[model samples]
Target: MKGVVVGGVSSGVGKTVATLATIRALDEAGYAVQPAKAGPDFIDPSHHEAIAGRPSRTLDLWLEGSEGMARNYARGEGDICVVEGVMGLYDGDGSSTAMVAEALDLPVVLVVDAKAGMESVAATAYGFREYAETIGREVDVAGVIAQRAHGGRHEQGIRDALPDDLDYFGRIPPSSDLEIPDRHLGLEMGAEAALPHEALSAAADHLDTERLVDVAREPPQVDPEPAGARTDATVAVASDAAFCFRYPATIGRLHERSTVQTFSPVAGDPVPECDGVYLPGGYPELHAEALASADTLTELGERAGEGLPVFGECGGLMAMSQSLSTTEGERYAMAGILPADVEMCDRYQALNHVDLEATSETLTARAGESIRGHEFHYSKASVDADARFAFETVRGDGIDGDHDGLLEHESLGTYAHVHAASGAFDRFVDRLR
Candidate 1:
């Protein structure tokens, strides 16, 4: 599909707003838009899906590799795709936005925060474009989207400052209505704090729709992998507001090997009849009382005690713990499947790319195997000192100083969220059989 990567100079540069406005501009131009994210950012893609009306593809080179990223891009359905970058253009290690642009051979549309200066924004975009070549990353910083710039002289001055090499795509006017709220983890989810439709449309009116589409070349072609035939085994996955941080690809992988069943613990839905359980991450802390009052955790505790394999990530790890306390120090009970107490805090405990090596055979990985994922959490767990951990840190901050993967009975829980391409879910699926 034809696409362009919307990158920023750094964090808080309004990449999400620019991307959404770009999507709206493309839609205004009568293009069926498919949105995607450059890194392992599950939250931004939620906004993309909200605007695009389809699940956005996740393209991370570190987690999915070049071939896997291409495959994921190829799976996206639409005439064009708008892939939003993470952090700055070349900020991340292997999973940077520049890497994805180079891997897919797509041009980069840098989002510049132009709320302050005019020529300075152009100069900053010029430096970012040139810096990519010095780093040996073949990324094309094709254009600039002036974020928070007013129409008349403001947008004109920014446009006049750009050189021949760089094109001025458009600007997102500074307005409070376009702002998305934030919490400890990141911006409040897209569905919760979405910008008004008129705001997006007005932003669209400011952007250069033709130039934006012109820079978007078709990504490198890769065939979509065929889905495996469904198996008789049922894999129960948690959904609803609490357990909602799952990647679409992860669920697709599970369905390839088994029947997928979904239930909401926050809604008091009991754990479904299944051979395996998958609890993805979301805002369990905000709904701790409802989750604790549900029969779902009790049933999950019982199933784990009966030797059922249960896997959890982030919020899932919190809900599976012995107890969970909110930021106000109000405590609520959890599944009590693992011997740990989770407590929410004002700041994130872990926020970075994570590499964990399995020290022992676990539900999702063999002993000594490595998994590449990411962890961003506001809660810390107080585990029993004698509790067994299946993984040791290779890169990021884990549950403890250098370890993660709290394992008990047949259940395994960790803060890191892995993609199916990492083979973590593959192992989980294999364990079910």
Candidate 2:
């Protein structure tokens, strides 16, 4: 599919709103739109999926090497793909939006906040376009989308001020309806706080849909790889608001290799009979009360003790711990399978692309194997001194400063959320067998 990157001049530059409006405009124009995110973020893609009615592709170079990243993009289905960028265009160290655009060879439509100046907006867009060259980056800032720009004089001034090279796509007018409410993690999940369709349609009407379609171009084609060997092993994945941070590609990989079943632990469903269990990262802290009393966790603890392989990441790590303490000072008993206590912090405890080398054989990787992933959470774990760990932190913070992957029984939990492209899921499935 042909694609274009919607990049912000900076964080809070309304890139999400602009991208949603662009997706709306494209969909209304009768194109099948595939939404994607340019970083290791789960929240913004929630909004993108809600609007586009499809799972947003996770495109990260750190988590997935260049070939893997391309494969993830290749798996997406649509006539056009709208990749919403992370932070500023060039702000990230591990996997910047500029790098993603350059790798895909896709044109970028810079989202310039036009809440203040007009000519200055064009100047900023020009600078962003030329700055890539200065940094030896081959990013094509093809045009500008005037975020929160007004019509008539304001929009015209932004459009007229643009140099002949930079195209003027359109603007997202300022509106309370255009705002998505956010909390600690990011914006509330799209299901809880989606922008009104009428509001999105109104915003879409102002955009140059034809021009955007013209600007969108195809990336280099990747030869499809043959399907891997399959297994009869069943994998039960936790699915609910509390455990919603799983990547679509992760589930897709599991489904391709084994029988996949899902149950809601937040709703108190008992754990399903399966060869293994996978609890993905999410907001288990928000539902600590419910999870504390969940039969799924109870049975999961029992099964884990009985040698059932279980793997948890981030929030999953918190849920699988001995206890969880909320920011409000309420402590709840957790699954008690892992020898650690988790505490929610007032601010994010750690957020970065992470690399881990297995200090010993674990559920996801073997001894001496390295796993690449990312961590973004608001909680910390107080692990027992005698607790066993599987991996040594090669980069970023883990459960403690030096280690990650708390190991107990046949289960392992970590703060790092790995993508299927990294071969972590493959090892996970193999271990399940």
TM-score of each: 0.97, 0.99
Q: Clashing pairs in model 2?
A: none
Give per-candidate clash totals: 0, 0
**lDDT value, candidate 1, whole model:** 0.90
> Best candidate, lDDT-wise?
2
TM-score of 1: 0.97
Q: Per-model C-alpha lDDT, please?
A: 0.90, 0.93
**Per-residue accuracy of model 2 over 54-128 as CA lDDT, tens digit each:** 999999999998888988999999999999999999998899999999999999999999989999998999999
Error of 2 at 191 (Å): 1.3
Across 1-433, the per-residue lDDT of candidate 1 in tens digits comes to 7999999999999999999999988998999999999998888999998888899899999889898889888878898999999999888886999989998999999998888899999999999989977877788999899888888998889889999899998788888989999877788887887778798998899888888878889976777776665667889999988888988888878887888999999999988899999999999999999988888899899999999989999999998999999989899999999999999988878888889999999999999999989988988999998999989999898899699999999999999999988988878877887
What's the CA error at residue 212 for candidate 2, in Å? Answer: 0.7
**Segments of candidate 2 deviating more than 4 angstroms:** none
